[model samples]
Target: MKDKKIERPIFPKKAIITAGMPYGNKDLHFGHVGGVFVHADTFARFLRDRIGNENVIFVSGTDCYGSPISASYLKLVEEGKYEGSIEEYVREYHEKQKEVLEKYEMSMNLYAASALDRAGEIHKGVSEEIFNKLYDNGYLAKASSPQFYDPDFKVFLNGRQVVGKCPIEGCSSDKGYADECDLGHQYMPDELIDPKSILSGKTPELRKVTNWYFKLEEYNNTLAERVDYLRANSNLRKNLLNTIEESLKPPVIFVKRKQLEGITDLEEKLPKHRTIDEPKKPSITFVFESLEDRDIARGVFDEVGVRFRTGKTLVPFRLSGNVEWGIPVPDKEELKALTFWVWPESLWAPISFTKTYLETIGKNPDQWTEWWHSEDSKVYQFIGEDNVYFYGIAEMAMFMALEGIKAGDKIDWDKINLPHLIANSHLLFMNKKASSSGAVKPPMARELLEYYTPEQLRMHFLSLGLSKGSVSFMPQVFMEEKDKQGPDTVLKDGNLLTNVFNRLVRSCFYTAQKHFNGTIPVGEISDSIMEESKEAILTYERHMYNHEFHSLIYVLDSYIRNMNKYWVNNMRVADTSDDNALRKQVLIDAFHAVRTVTTLIHPIAPKSCEKVREYLNVNENLWNWEYIFEPVYKFIVDQTMHKLKFLEPRVDFFEKHQSQISF
Candidate 1:
């Protein structure tokens, strides 16, 4: 019996791809590039080929309005390291970030910043628009919450201005800020343990402050349904799905067994809840049906002097804060003197960037709705694993709520066009998670180019399998003397392009130049070669659609290496016998393989692949998916008269850097 043919995954008619915005306070580190941007850009490029270039928009920006930026700027001012104002400081870093992304060959249509130039102005408008939509839909509520304030400094602290131990139960994050930790766990300000104000070097006190929040808890059921739909239909990462599921669980409070003993009337005094008392565990858990009940129970526990820590669950998503460096929140009645919180505002910054790019290109700014709101369109967000909670949960719930979809309302997933998240695990440095604020500092994205070409780094990063697990980047240039002599593990996948694939293409072109007067030899390609090329193309398309990038790399490696072996074996007979017909047949078959492999890898290493097209004398249409499966002769305008470009000696379609060649 014959095997059933595999079907290709369907792509959306239009797509918008966004990489998580990098903080504007500093230049991008390797994690920002390897873990997120490279993946996002590759997919965007593929979509342009699969769909049409006009139907795709790729965007990201600098997250400029956070307290982290303000805090970092203040420290620089105090140390006399920078003499510029806060705005100038972020602008400088924003430009530097854009420059570095360009150096890494990240092809963003617009890398706008939320606090710079026309993008900033558009972001302010977008912020107010989303805020008003949520308010009109009754999704927003103003809550009076305790915000961290330092008595010594006589000022309220936000975000990085205050540091503390994370109070979230079981979180191992090393650094906790005012509301969220470095690992992206969110908690109420009052729940942070041993809070200290960075401005005063003293313990901070909680002061009542009013801010706007999206009632995220109200959409618990809606988000659950969305998760179920994605789990069933889409290829979401399991870790990301588990993280979102954990967030959707009923709220729970953990209290020590000893504290529960002292408060004998706790059950009578608290809101309705179930107590899970385990003899083996040190703490008693109180689970509530709703976030409101959990908060009431928490207050009662506080009044009864019971020490408790909150568990991971949905809470009201804060939308505004008192940070002066942020986008000004619109004046809504007496709710004044506030700014949009960095996270919430950053979520919508891509929309602003889309509008800015459209306007810049002489298109209607409102055309962005066609890409964002239409059922024919899809948005793919590439983010790190730590951010799954925000991008997967909070952002989805807010987008739905803004469209007037309430908790119990039946959702039409088709009309909503919610974003599809692609989350990646951490890109570790030397087997340890590295960040700018962490103990092990990460290498900046630009510094990597000194030892490796952008194409080499791009190939290596795409093969890391970050979608499955944390992968360490072990560049030999940064290794100790004892580990620097051998081949770097990071270069293994890249060598498939710079070494194996390079030799294959060079051999094909040089042989054609040597034997056939620099013109592609005319003959029929063998059925065996055609079947192999088709199988590789189909497998590659499937992997690309599922975002199994590492698997796609393996397919390319095997197919290209096999094609090269076929060339060496067949060319030996043709060269020995001096048979013109057999030589032409070999060139015809080999050149067809070259065309197919080059097009398949165009998205991964665009610059080098485009050089192949230049040497082949083909137009940009060579990359269009419509002609992706066709033979090379189909693209030749006049088979008999066509003359190929001459191949110069030692020219490489893909080249390693001079320094890397020695290594």
Candidate 2:
């Protein structure tokens, strides 16, 4: 396979971090935090730890284009300067996100996007280049089409910006964008009655307009193959695979062209009616009754592999010249009419910023090529379910094309080497509370980070994630559920961070106090704690590698709890006078176990882990697995007894009670 593993990278070992493009239209909620940024941050930190920092690079940015942005731009135009322009608007949000994440102690190598560099040329150039390619390939069309034109506003209401009557049977809320109805019925534009532009407040005029499209339908087969590839390889969640399969299946265009009455030819004025059209040059062309009927006609043509009699190829229309708002056609206007074109997929601004940082620091642009182009790069994009279309499909198509692979066409489906990894998370509802309006559940990353330590939050989510497709924000459920039963458990309110912190403190305290007291001499870690420590370290390595974060969380918690348990159970009953050295060795063993657990947990919470490293007087570098075990063993054997205090684990019952009741 072209994508078969390469010799594991020897230099700048390829790792790429992509946070899903955030639309600048609305303020971000918590689910956004958990799904994209938090996940991306985790992976970045993991890779950074796996390979030295110089080799791993993280990239993320904001999306600031297309209809959503244009609408916002127009809205701002009316108000004479938006609090921020579209570019500025997206930049602000990305900055706010960075601020929040930094508070949580996220560090990334690159944050690339427009704010970091005037990407106007890159954006325009990429879109133009794509358009030129499709156009030259005969995938563009210049036919006049009836779009919802708002004459009052002197602009077209791109399908998304229009809102109207609720379409679900007996429902009363507005049918805005056609993503989904409150009743869960996916609706089309025609389904909306009394449809009006949110901008002009006027009934739209169905006016003939010209636009571009990236013959997505042309790539149906390739897309299906990709989906099958993902399904076969289990590259995506099962539900996500199903969604792509359903969406990428050839768009069944049943709409047919309406036949005209008493009209035909270029010389005659076009039909006054907006919905109908006549062929300017005709003979071989026959008009069908309606778009749906025309689709039936097209299907027949497709089945038979119809060829044009006029020697003009019927290139599948891929790109469009839609001028409502977007990157403009960089080519000559006359040539554009004859070409199929599409704007390049936009990335968020922070990613562009990161790109600039890379360049400014004297890193060659080719540094990015290693990750973007290499088969071994193993690109994983973390995003929410809402963004599957763009991130999952559209972006993949662009990259495939750039890599000289033809998407949507058949060669060998199995041979098509696209990005090997795609990790998408679903919405994490705020609290355990379900809302009546069916509003998306918010994420808990930001809020949880405020009160609890980051390690707790990371473990909580990882435990919750546990290889499942959907994760809920039922913090209480996460907190209470455990893989093992114990009377004195450590996890609390899905907030087990403090528990980890206390365990570290106790481990250090026990190790030091034993040395000072001249109790059981600290000779070597007892076989019991050593075995347990190995299990904890091994469990972390296995779960994290498999992306089984949630499962790892349970094991990690159990490891800490058991280590503490080992001490409580043994220390109270030990014969301290008989072999003072051996008695202290037990405490030393417990400390060693704590050290291993804390180091393993560091990927989730670096600062807390650092504190543990600092107190032990161990260099931070020893936290890596290759050293953690050996050092712990050495430390166990080297110590006499040490001075420290083992504080009882604190459970904030008042806070736990309030959290339980909040939902």
Off by over 4 Å in 1: 1-4, 258-263
* Cα-based lDDT at residue 604, candidate 2: 76
Model 1 residue pairs with clashes: none
Global lDDT of each candidate: 0.88, 0.52
Q: For model 1, where is the 10-residue window of minimal lDDT?
A: 1-10
lDDT for each residue of candidate 2 in 475-499, tens digit (9 for 90 to 100)? 4333445633452221352345554
RMSD of each: 1.7, 10.0
Tens digit per residue, CA lDDT, model 1, 401-503: 8767788898766567788889999999999999898799999999998988888888899999998999999998999888776778778888999999899
- Quality of model 2 by C-alpha lDDT: 0.52
All candidates: TM-score: 0.97, 0.72
Best candidate, lDDT: 1
